[model samples]
Target chain A: MTTSAIAEALRLHPGPVDLASIETDAAPGFDGKKADGQTALADLGSELSDLQERLWAERTAGSERRVLVVLQGMDTSGKGGVLRHTIGLVDPQGVRITSFKAPTDEERAHDFLWRIEKGLPPAGYIGVFDRSHYEDVLIARVRGFAEPDEIERRYGAINEFEARLVDEGVSIIKCMLHISADEQKARLAERLANPDKHWKYNPCDIDERAFWPAYREAYETALERTSTQIAPWHVVPSDKKWFRNLAVGQLLLDTLRGLDLQWPAADFDVEAETARLIGEAPVQ
Target chain B: MTTSAIAEALRLHPGPVDLASIETDAAPGFDGKKADGQTALADLGSELSDLQERLWAERTAGSERRVLVVLQGMDTSGKGGVLRHTIGLVDPQGVRITSFKAPTDEERAHDFLWRIEKGLPPAGYIGVFDRSHYEDVLIARVRGFAEPDEIERRYGAINEFEARLVDEGVSIIKCMLHISADEQKARLAERLANPDKHWKYNPCDIDERAFWPAYREAYETALERTSTQIAPWHVVPSDKKWFRNLAVGQLLLDTLRGLDLQWPAADFDVEAETARLIGEAPVQ
Candidate 1:
């Protein structure tokens, strides 16, 4: 499939989002097998690198436009994996990635978006949030960490906040790495079985598995309420890791292409600079 | 040559230094043409990635150790190049990079090390400084940005600060990317020649080229005064971008290998976690 189609295919339409109906293992809008998808993703790297440099250059020229990728999913849904394989393709200098953890006392004292605003990328950057504001809605709603009225208020607050970001030239790509409960079980089993991966296996992950249905319902509600025209969520089927990487890579590429970035024009006379450099005496 | 030997060969000894004598185009320890060096660097990627992961995992197990790479160079000397090619080999998530620009009013208000301390990576991270506290001695002396006594004081202060960090488990890899005056002129010319690269060119870079001799003398003094037993400097011959990348890559690999990082043992019962995961009911 064409790269642009990948975004349209994976983007959650406005309305109810029945994540259970989505196939976790399916490579939507992608042709061929896993190897082909990997190859295609690799092919996209150079173009992504060039476009990202253009975006970075534009920042030097006073453009405030930037891209923010928000990734959300259950544990072992391959958030880190996507970060390494997909986002890793770009120059790390131009990318700002934040992996938000549980809020500190200081952060908890302020509005949830305060910490998030601090993490936003400046002009000419591709900002990545490994997990972001959605958690305040997802886990907070699933575990009853907040009141129902507070949770309801957050949905609107988030929508308006995102809308304002979009208005200010921040292009946000929100992705839910959709994976199956069975897949999560298998991944957890693998982590438990491997001595090398022991650091990754947390016991709380098992406790969270008990709330799978509630988490799924929370995701559905979050997706339905906040997946707006300005900033939509893409339900990336992540059972196949390669496809997940490819889908996100294509989404980023399309978003950058949509901007049609150009190299910033030089603010100085090239000839004058070249002559000045040539005339400079060599150091003894 | 062994990677360990790469570090030894490039390491500036504890004595007087001569920047003019070093051949910028020569690959001192690496025995290969450009293609071979490129392949060698590429080959180190997986091992670098594995070691970096282990270092990251050890942090979760309460290990306070981390790695810091400090890169210094003249304009067009490839500090950014090393960042993109060499340091970019590792996972960006585990790396914290800071590019020190001209000091802001806030930074200049306090002692020089204040900003450097703020940028230090936490446990389990690999911190990269594009330019660092040495600037207090380098530019501050060359351009009369600070008093001679203050510049002299900074050299001692920097040594003590770095020694303390080393005492606390931060391994410092301080590299000064060395390039010839002829090569700087060539690179500056190229930047002026290529419209796409104009963003990287600054008219002030041309002005800085006039102070070449003073800057080299300043670098020599800085290297002589501050190459501590704990954090010795390595002069990376950076005229050949490929060798510069390879030398820094090998330096990083050798340092990470020296740490002998191992995955942290599980703090939870694996069997119980597996059993709990297997027993969880699947989501409907």
Candidate 2:
């Protein structure tokens, strides 16, 4: 399949999105087994690295184009895993990663998008947000952390903020890692079984599980209200970790390829510089 | 050889250091050809990943420990290469990399270390500075950006600053990537020869070549003054890119291993959390 077609297959179409209708275990567009998916991801690594370098190179030539990947998921939906396995493919030098946690007193004092605006990648970079301004709509709505009218207003605000970013040359990729409740339970159990993973376990994760339906509704409503043509959301199945990594990797690869980034032309005379370098004396 | 022993061999001892005496192309501690070094580096990737995760895990349990790698070198010394090939082995999410360029007007207004201070990694991060506060001594001295007495004071100030950081649980790995004048010319020529590499080619780099001897002397003096017991410097040969990558990777591995990090124990009852997760109802 063509790269864009593969991306389109994973992309959530505009309108209402039903959480229950999607199969969390199915590898939607990929025609492969676990090993094949791994091999494909490995191949995508080199391609992604090369494309990212071009994107970075353009920045050096004063281009403002950049990519922002916003990953949102419930606890144990493998947001961290995608960062490690998929985003890990490129040069960390060219990537800016921000994992947004609970709002600080200062962050709460500002507009929801204020901290996010500060975290945007500069010219020629890929920025990843493990959780983002979406949290204000996701967790905030579920937990009733904001006023009902305020929560209702944020959806339009987020859409406008994103549209402005797109106009300013930011390509945004939003992925909602979709996993079954059974899969989350199994993953949580594995974390409990492994002593080394104890640091990742939070009792609050269990507390959050009680509000799963509410969170799902929030996600569904958010996806419907905010999945714009400019910045669409891709609901990645996360029951199979390999598929999640592969899908996101492919999506990034397609986005980069779509940009058609070229090696920035030399503004200086290459011949003159080469001659000057050749004529320079070696240090004694 | 033990990892520490390999690290020890690459370290610059406290004494007068001569740039001319060191072979820029030699793989000092590693007994390997290019392919062998590549294999060895690939092996370090997984090991480094595991160690970094453990360090990251420590932060969740309130450990303040972190690692800072300071990279300093002349132009075309492969600092970016090490970041891509060596540091890229670990999860980018866990690594904080800052590439310092010439200071802005605001930065010039304050002490040099002020900018460096702001870039320090928080708990659980492996921070890599492509160029660091060392620039104040090296470039500032060569270019006369600061007064003689002011430059002299920075060395002592740097020692005290680094010592304080060590006391606060930051392990410093400082490396000066050493490359020969001939090697730099070749790399610069290659950049000029390739259109794709034009973005990386800077005319100022050629201008900087004229100050080689001055810069070398500045490096020697800075090394003599600031190579403290709390934060020593390693002079890694960089003409051979593979060895440079391998040596830095090994140095980072050794520093992480020295920390003796263990996964933090669970603060909550794992069994109870598991039971609660298992009993949670599936969202309709």
TM-score of chain B of each: 0.97, 0.97
User: In CAPRI terms, where does candidate 2 land?
Assistant: medium
What's the lDDT for residue B271 in model 1? Answer: 84
lDDT (0-100) at residue B17 of candidate 2? 87
Q: In model 1 chain B, where is the ten-residue run with the lowest total lDDT?
A: B1-10
- Compose the digit string of candidate 1's lDDT tens values, residues B110-133: 989999999999999999998999
**Model 1 RMSD in angstroms:** 1.5
In model 2, what are the clashing residue pairs, if there are any? none
Docking class of 1: medium
B25-132 per-residue lDDT for model 2 (tens digits): 999888889999999999998889999999999999999999999999999999999999999999998999988999999998998999999999999999999999
Query: Following a full C-alpha superposition, what root-mean-square deviation does model 2 have from the true structure?
Result: 1.4
DockQ of 2: 0.79
